[model samples]
Target: MNTHLLMIEDDHRLAQMVAEYLGHNGLQVAHQADGTSGLAQLQSPDTGSLPDLVILDLMLPDMDGLEVCRRIRALPGPAAQVPVLMLTAKGDPMDRIIGLELGADDYLPKPFEPRELLARIRAILRRRGDGGTPAAGQSLRFGSLEIDRDARTVTVGGQVADLTSYQFDLLVTLAERAGRVLTRDQIMEAVRGRELEAFDRSIDVHMGRIRAAIEADPKSPKRILTVRGVGYVFAKQQE
Candidate 1:
């Protein structure tokens, strides 16, 4: 079955181009010009047919794309868990960081190459489907924290962690290499299959989000620790 995608973009010409391009690449695209209607489409009566992924543009006529992304994550059932890739023309790093903090699986700046967009979409889908490069049937446990590799689920103290697809992979990557410090570059390479960009803080933002979900106190994290002037390491033992 072809992957289904919902694009919430206000630019009609751009939307049409993306939809057609993605369509030719084995995706079924549904485009909505406004956030309100796009959200309604996500809440359609046929719950079984929700889009596999959502490509949301930051500029919308009805509402901000960040809000739309939040609403999508707030949706009930499987719809809330749908992967989202944010698109924006903003050059500010904080905008991208905010989008990721709100549960977006990926972010792409506007005026981007359609090929790069396609690659990002494929990477998100691949991670969501296979849990990245981890071995099948693998599981990790530290104190009350449990990670089910094949199932791609994380729970701390018996409570499920609300982690986006990317965050989950990042956690898994760290946990699997517990007790060993990994630089941001290494982490990005392992989780994203790409080198880290210069001064890119996306990984740090994701770590903060993950810590908030699993740590008893995100202010002073216990599971994932920072190494000054280095990188981060997942504690081999959790208290």
Candidate 2:
């Protein structure tokens, strides 16, 4: 079945172009010109059966895209399961960081190539398992840390850890590939479904936060180790 997509862009020309292109690429596209209407479409009775992804533009007639993103992230159940890729003219690192921090899965600067846009869309959908099977029933245990894919929860040292969607995915990706030295670019591609920003430190900041939550001693972490001049690695536990 073709994956459904909801595209919220105020520009009629851009919306029509994107919708047509994505439709030709085998996606079922639903277009909305405003955030309010987009939210309505997302909340409609048929929403449960609607889009698997949302492409949201930052400039909206009624509300900011960040607010729309927060509302979507705050939604409960299957609605919240839908991943969003933010589109904006602003290329500021702070803007991108804020979008991610607000639960946007990824961001694309305007004046981007349509090919790049397609790549981003495919990457997001692929990571979200539209292109592959999801690990739905698996559980992983390393030392006192336990990851439950079924419940979408993580427990560390017998204590439940509150993690954002991105953080949980990042931890899972790292834990599943323990002992592998994943560079920042690799890690960003793995978890965020896009290329890393040249000067972004959001990944490092998130890693630190995850360590503080899961590691016995965040100052001297054992599970997630930093490799000098490289990136981060999940250290395999020694039995």
Candidate 3:
């Protein structure tokens, strides 16, 4: 099945270029000029099934991309959980940080090479297992926390935790090697199937977001601990 991707961008030219490029590479692209229409389409039941992924632009003609991301996360059902890849023209690290915190699966800065964009898209979709087969009955449990690899979900104390697709995988990577201290490079390398792609401190940001979802107290985390000068390690013993 060709992956369906929704591009919510105001730049018609760029959208066209991306659509053509991705279309050639097995993705069906749908264009939306603003966040309002994008959100409306996502919320509308008549739109049929949700897209596999959303390519959201940070600057929109109608609403801020951050607001759109917030609303997307608030939407009902699977629509709220669709992976988002944010696009920004600005060269600010804060934008990437905020976007990830707001539930974006990934981000690509503007003036980016199309090949790199394709690679990133492939990486995200691969991590999400776009159309790949799922491993049966594979789930990791530590105390009340359950990481369901098949369902691509995390549940804490019987309640579902809100984690982005990428974050979920990151957690699994750590959980699989619980009690081991992995440096930023090693962690990224472990997850780098078809190129995990990393920016400085990106993993840290994702870790913070993951902690907020799974940890009882994000400020003083227990599930995933920071080793100060080292990287991070998932606690083998959990409550």
Candidate 4:
């Protein structure tokens, strides 16, 4: 079955081009020109089925894309958890950070190549379990931290950690290779199936979010340690 994708973009020409391009790549692309209609489509009962992913443009006639993403995350059940990849024409770093903070799975700046978009889409979907079924009994325990790959859940100190889908996968990537220092490039490649760009801080932001969820003190994280001028490492032994 083809992956379903919803594109909430106001630019008609861009939307059409992206839809057609993604369609040719085995994705079922649905488009809405405004945030209002897009939100309605997501909540509609007769929509048949929810999309596996959302490609959202930051600029919209009705509402800001960040607001749309927040509303989506506030939706009921599975709808709230739908992965979002933000599109922004703005060059502001804050916009990207805000999008990710609001649970967007990824982001791409304007003027990006269609192939990069496809790569990002595939990477997000792969992390969301579209690639293949996770191995059974694939659970990891680091003292108080527990990760259940099959269930896609994580708990710290007997408490469930509220993590976005991307953050959860990032944690798993680190945990699976505990004690090894993974550079930002390696981490992004492993988690997103893409290389890190210079001055890109998305990984750092996501790491902060993940630490906040699992660490007893995010100010001084124990589970994920950062190496100066290097990258991050998951502690081999955790208390």
Q: How far is candidate 4 from the true structure (C-alpha RMSD, Å)?
A: 1.8
Error of 2 at 7 (Å): 1.0
Task: Estimate every model's Cα lDDT from 0 to 1.
Answer: 0.90, 0.81, 0.88, 0.90
Measure candidate 1: CA RMSD.
Answer: 1.5
Q: After superposition, how far is residue 141 of candidate 1 from its true place, in Å?
A: 0.8
Model 1 steric clash pairs = none
lDDT, candidate 4, residue 167? 91
lDDT of 4 by residue, 110-225 (tens): 97899989998998888888897689998999998999999888998778887878998999999999999999999998887767878898999999889888998999999999
Write down the lDDT that model 2 would get: 0.81
Candidate 2, residues 80-172, lDDT tens digits: the string is 667888997755667666777777776788877878888888877766666675576889889889988767678986788755556777888
Question: In model 1, where do residues sit more than 4 Å from their true spots?
Answer: 130-134
Clash tally for model 4:
0
RMSD of 2: 3.5
Give per-residue CA lDDT, model 1, range 40-159, as digits (tens): 999997987799899999889999999999999999888888999999765778889899999999899888999989899998988888324557777899999999877788998888
Please report the candidate that would top TM-score against the real structure: 1
Lowest lDDT block of 10, candidate 4: 40-49
Q: lDDT of candidate 1?
A: 0.90
Off by over 4 Å in 2: 134-137, 149-169, 189-197, 205-229, 235-239
lDDT of 3 at 154: 93
TM-scores for every predicted model: 0.96, 0.80, 0.94, 0.93
